[model samples]
Target chain A: MTERQDCASLLVQHLGWIERVAASLSRRNGLSGDEAEDFASWAKAKLVEDDYAVLRKFRGESALTTYLTVVLTMLYRDYRVAQWGRWRPSAAAKRRGPAAVRLETLVYRDGYRWRQAADLMHSRGETDLSEDELGKLLADLPAGSRGRPRQVGEAAMAAITDGADAEAGVHAAEAEQERQALGTALARAMQGLNDEDRAILRMRFWQGYSVADVARAMRLDQKPLYRRIDRLLSRLRTELEKAGISRERVRVLTDEDAA
Target chain B: MKGRIDDAERLAALLEGRVTDGERAALLAELARSDDGLEILGDAAAVTRELEEEDRAAGVLPIRAPRPGARPRLSARTGALLAAGIAGLLLAPLAWRAGRIPQGSYAMNLSRRVAVAGKGLPPGVGSAPRTSVRGADDGLSPGARAVRLGARQVDLHLARIAGDAAAAGAASRDAARLLHAVAGAGTAAAVYERAAAPAGEAVADRDLEAADANAERLAGTAAVRLGAWCEAARFAATRRDAAFFRDTRREVAELAATRGLPSGAGPALGDLRTVLDGGGPVDWAGLRTRLDVLLGAAGG
Candidate 1:
């Protein structure tokens, strides 16, 4: 048989398998019945596109069914992304790697709480970060208007930002300036450390991974990692002191309720 | 370009649970080298699982039937005797559980004889379905029996290597039950060891073909068992069940390096041994793929 004939024959033989796989994909992505049928049709067309380019990619190393499943899955993901526009991670999250980006997407875009996002990530073996760690990682992230929207009325907003009284507004301005100064000092101190030390700090404190997890991921002994983190913290404290940021001031700035 | 194609093939094999230990390790290493690779692995797995669920719901078999022809011939009397013997073996466990047959009694002796007799049967007879009724399988041709057994083995091995403790444990029990049915209370390991031993001389082409097919089947079964144990170890490691992980790892290493296995199985086994001994994180997915490939190659 000619190549086209061969492809057509193969497609006819595996049509049931293809539709089953497509339906499964649609169900997983929460497609309606009509949408699922549409997806199946789209998948069939895509398979025959470019003269069965996707189907022809099979190399016979694995079972024909398995190869087709992987191909169809990739196609399904593409279809979902095109239709739903999956949440894009910010450049900052991207820099932290895929795990961080996924966590951010789950929380900021998908409306999951920090703990829920961390739990999801852990279940998928994507990240081992605790909820607190996930919170810390995104603490400095530029807030997006996706999940947690502030819907204060004009009066409430004015009372809070402008303040009900002038004295209250002045006190708030002073506190904000002090908080920014402390944040700048903390960043400067972090920059003084080596890359590995910085990463260790980030994993331990910023990302909220437990000591054991960080040690395991980095292939370090637990006891040594614990000591190393302490030493790094001391170094950061010394740097902050040099920058005129006192330990007391740092504590107040970092205090959640105080802020 | 070739590398990408090879990786895709490797990924497909991994997804289908058909890779050897070595290929699994290589693919995992490749995936671990980049975030994109990990993302792809996760995505592929997620999709494949959904399809598998659908397959299960539709009552589809995990594996296709054997190719047509190549049936090993057996006399009618022999088929009947084998079927009756296998049926007795299947019920031996229940008899033991019911306290009707004591350990190492008449039932045990009878099972040992049946096991020995079973060795002389066709290559795929070792994997005969546990659900077969007495005299029911006797009516089918040897090729049909082989197909039925092959499908059953695939399903069993897939369950064992499913990466869930409950499922793997249940599969182990089923496998044990099958072995117990055959050996009349013999340990599963003993049967596996006997099966893994070198085959005797075959005088005729037909005998040689049967021996070769049997050897391949045994090897494939061993590879699947190894994969299952490795998967168990991986699950245990995730749960920090050190004892279970250690025990399963040791078992896998021993099985992989068993004597008289095909030379084709050496590289994968060797790689598995190295990984088990490395004292580092085991790439269970990679090891699973490698074993899958070995099983597939063995015609399982």
Candidate 2:
């Protein structure tokens, strides 16, 4: 066979690893294979362009496979950041096509559950997962939290069987949350806490802790406890900057409210 | 800045259970500082609050371990009391074990398993734990300290054939150990728990009721199955294992039986049988190819 065939064969042989890397990036960062393929092709192009000089030296440092894995990973990260910067607004853009568009719509606008499931499956390709396992994971999703709310089990089975284009659906859904992005306000609101305060805040607003229980547990007398709560609110207000959420949104609820 | 107050001392006194009314007032005033300092103090208080909330929510919280600086300051008498408390908590597993039945087939010989499983214990242990070396019974690998805890063909093969009791029982203890090894190799616990259902049945209540008998039964059964597989793998490797499996020897072994056949076929075949039998190298690609061929053949 020709050199091209040899290279192609080698590429085909390691296709699983290459795909695994792609799937992992998709899962972790919600990148599609088009995005994944772009990163990989760029890495390979760079590695091969310079007369195989860097690639040869890389061969000596680690096994060719290991070196390729590292280089591909680094290149993907750098290329992704660069690509991301180049098309900032289009970061949430989904390509045309029923499958891809649907995936993007589901992830971005429909429900966090399908996006999360797809993200997990994408992130963990052939990762000790069986169809049954994925099915079970879908079934176990918070009892009543299906995106379809209309479908369960077999209907949900479409997610996997139709998955050839289902991933396009993931890409589509990813574009949905573009409207309400994680921004500076949320980031700042999260600041100024030692790990403990952060944990408490998480337990409180996010986790929905009640004031009375929190006060009692912290061993604070009510007056002093009220003061601390005030300080937390003030800090949160300063941090939110204008995340559209207000002090009223910062809830400390009883178990009844939590339920 | 305002005059520095030794609130640390006041808090230390409070922590020491000697909080005077005067000291309590002073500590509260200092804790109410604003901006960054207040934030830091608030964070500390909040962390303490979180710890408490975690206690209430979780129903139990890990004890506050004293930092190194505070260690020597602990009164020896208090230290002794603390040590006793530590001992009681540390031995909670022993207390827990005393009351409960061993849950699964792959019972970690507590002492032996602990010696190897350094750090990141299942739930409760006092001492530092580490991943221990695979024992002789755990099976050895070809190279120097090649104690690889990779996926067992048996487990994968059994999991694929769910509801098959014969395969499940013969492979239960081995499958569980394979999972133990896989979990050691960083497989998620959910996978094992799912596998454990079938594995539980494999080594039934009656089997485990007699510990020595159970161990002997598993050891002997695994030895036979593994011996057959291992021997088959070795011979196929040397172009002999396949020979035996086919109920024929090298005298009539096919040309394909020769090692290093084209497309790495013969060697790959060796890999397939090796993995299928007792413990062997993880030739993932070879196994996949074998499956593909078998799948194709069956389809045809």
| Top candidate (lDDT) | 1
Please list the residue runs of candidate 1 whose C-alpha ends up more than 4 Å from where it truly belongs after superposition.
A30-35, A81-259, B1-7, B20-22, B57-59, B64-300
Candidate 1 chain A minimal-lDDT segment of 10 residues: A250-259
Question: What is candidate 2's lDDT per residue for B1-300, written digit by digit as tens?
Answer: 132222222232333223444553454444333222222232233334443353446433222222212324466699789989998999877886743554422222111111111111111111111123343355432221111111122222222223344333333333344333331322322233344465444433323323322332333322222322322232122211121233322212332243322232244444445555644333323433453342222111
User: Chain B, TM-score, each prediction?
Assistant: 0.27, 0.22
- DockQ scores for all predicted structures: 0.10, 0.02
DockQ top scorer: 1
Q: Write the per-residue lDDT of candidate 1 for residues A61-112, one digit (tens) a residue.
A: 4545556666776677567567546433444554454566666666666666
Query: Across residues B1-300, which tens digit of lDDT does each residue of candidate 1 receive?
Result: 124423555666555444444554555444433433443444455455455455456543333211111122356589679889998999876875744322332111211211211011111222321334223324533222232233333333333222223332333333333332232334332332233233211122232223223422532444434433433332232222333434345555666666544444466557656755777544434543554444333222
Of all native A–B interface contacts, model 1 reproduces a fraction of 0.22
Best by TM-score: 1
Q: Distance (Å) between predicted and true CA of B80, model 1? A: 30
lDDT of each: 0.48, 0.36
